[model samples]
Target: MSERVIKPVGRGFLFLDSHPAGCARIVREMSGQVEQRTPERRTALVVGSSSGYGLATTIAGLARYGIDGVGVSFEKAPTARRTATAGWYRTAETAALAAELGRSWTFINADAFADTTKDEVLDLVAEQLGGIDHLIYSVAAPRRVDPRSGETYQSALKAIGGAHTTKSLAFDDGEPVLQEVGIDVATDDEIAQTVKVMGGEDWARWITALQERDLLKPGFNTVALTYIGSELTGPIYRRGSIGAAKADLEQTALTLAKDGVTAWTSVNGAAVTQASSAIPGIGLYVSLLHKVRGLETPVQQSIALWDQLTGEAPLDLDDDGRIRLDRWELTDDVQSAVRAQWESATQDNIAEVADTTWFLSEVRRLYGFDVAGVDYEAETEVDVAWPDH
Candidate 1:
């Protein structure tokens, strides 16, 4: 037996098998956090449910709340010569685990930005799940094509106000190196396009489509994940083009609230994910965040969100009417520590100032590497199938 040698490929990494033990560990952790469950059986519809927070939410809903789920995602499948995306393997493991626990689950591998995908989800909820009690929108993409207008939009991570310079981590020959990254201000068109692609427009569209089909259960709740980081990365994250999109998303939530749907914008903490790793300067900031605040994993964060949404107490909201799941990361002491580290982080001292080793391990784990109890040297099946419910 030879150890599985996974390597970075294009924008994603390749790995043959998902660690079942690792997946189960995450599910158990999420389930253990549930103090109480809803009295009535619930069903959830999750968009972008293959990876990151989306995947964690799906697993937590089923394992903790006993909620059946229908997930919509776009992920590549395995081939004879290559492995499937990590999300594909993760979803397969999730389905198998859900089946083992007698939980209902359905997953659709398709583009959530398209009308066809929305229609398919609506039909699934209408015919199989009856109606959805919770709708989770957690899709993050670089580009989107409008189904109605046939117009394409690409999201940008440029600073909104002006040029900004920050320290960034770049992988050089499989090693992390600190580099100075300067981002130019985004153009007006770029800002508009970023808002179009990453904003809550598609989320609003999905809600409207579900409403038209009457697939939303009475008193159903919908929430879309957003991020508002501290000042350290605010130029490219919280106060950048992505920030504009989030503002638009929050506004969308307001409009949806008026239409009798409980819509919320959940401001989440920054964590290492395929999406966040691509954002300039985020890798370094997250590394510092991990060192300072012991940032929570997506599974932990998802459990927190679920607990808030279904807790015995009413949903906790900030003064702005948004759920502040990021308060832990935004505390004064944490921010001060992160700022001190950010100012001193350099190529020569980054390793001492931040937990780069842990950050790198987390990145590898995203692609099914570094899982405990998984024999990397053992032969494993690459062509895994989703469980039949």
Candidate 2:
């Protein structure tokens, strides 16, 4: 007899929205990367620790490697009637679990771009944990509102002239259908702004701050996650504005190496993460990675990110100090097979070109709606309070 209206308190904010079981699964998966026999007390700092690859790294540090950690994020909690974002709730839950397991940790809610935020993080790490041995950066944002200038900087993806429409896949439904989307060619200022927010400048700043504070230990190790898809999805992603930012990231990794900082980028195999799903032609790519890895091992198994973080040898890294997991390059043979199919792909050959069953099912699983062993109809709730604005 009543209609409840929901106007969320924070801008684009949510609370208690992560699938607990899935978060656990990912954390457990990452923990397996820690060698069984090694025993050591390690301290870590994970920037962008709330979701996606950043969260995965944090989980690995705690659950798998038995390392205590400090997490820096801007994660907000969910409001009533509005669903919470996955990272917000998962971070809270993960912290709770880690506590029960006797892991020492700290999670900070602060804008990483600000000098004040960076200093605060450094202070926290130094006071509580002594110093950091590992640092992981995994931040991706659409825009950066300059704290000082009060100017809003927005990011764009390069779409060719005119409106571009392509066959988009929706996980809720198993279909590859055409969806009309438009993107603007970036002006010089827009490109600079996007790069500033997403590029290595901020990453370098974070490292500098920690080092200045003497918060970095002698065996300092750091990892930043990056991505590269096959040429088939190049136009919409790899060659787009985001791709440009990633290029900067790759270059930064190389520069960090020159500085004597042990830094490596892990080009992760595609999985449905909050950041990756936002990209244009990524649905099909995620599907393929899942299908191929599923038949063999989970995405976590294929990625040696946790190994790299723990200083384990034999973890593969590209020439420029980044791990290449294009999924296309996994088996070499597997990539060749996909390339052949994609080259001959046409609207008529959509079914043959794309594996509809795998892609569609993975998409649905992204929203926690179609995941096996998950009861989608069951009512779920998570309790987390994002810091006030």
| lDDT of all predictions | 0.81, 0.64
The per-candidate count of clashes, in order, stands at 0, 6
Which candidate comes out best when scored by TM-score?
A: 1
Q: What is the C-alpha RMSD of each candidate to the true structure, in Å?
A: 2.8, 4.9
TM-score of model 2 relative to the true fold?
A: 0.81
- Badly placed stretches (over 4 Å) of model 1 are 1-39, 387-389
* Model 2 per-residue lDDT tens digits across residues 164-192: 54445443233455344455566666667
Best by lDDT: 1
Q: Which residue segments of model 2 deviate by more than 4 Å?
A: 1-37, 148-150, 159-166, 171-184, 289-303, 327-332, 343-368, 371-374, 385-389
TM-score of every candidate relative to the true structure? 0.92, 0.81
* lDDT for predicted candidate 1 compared with the true structure: 0.81
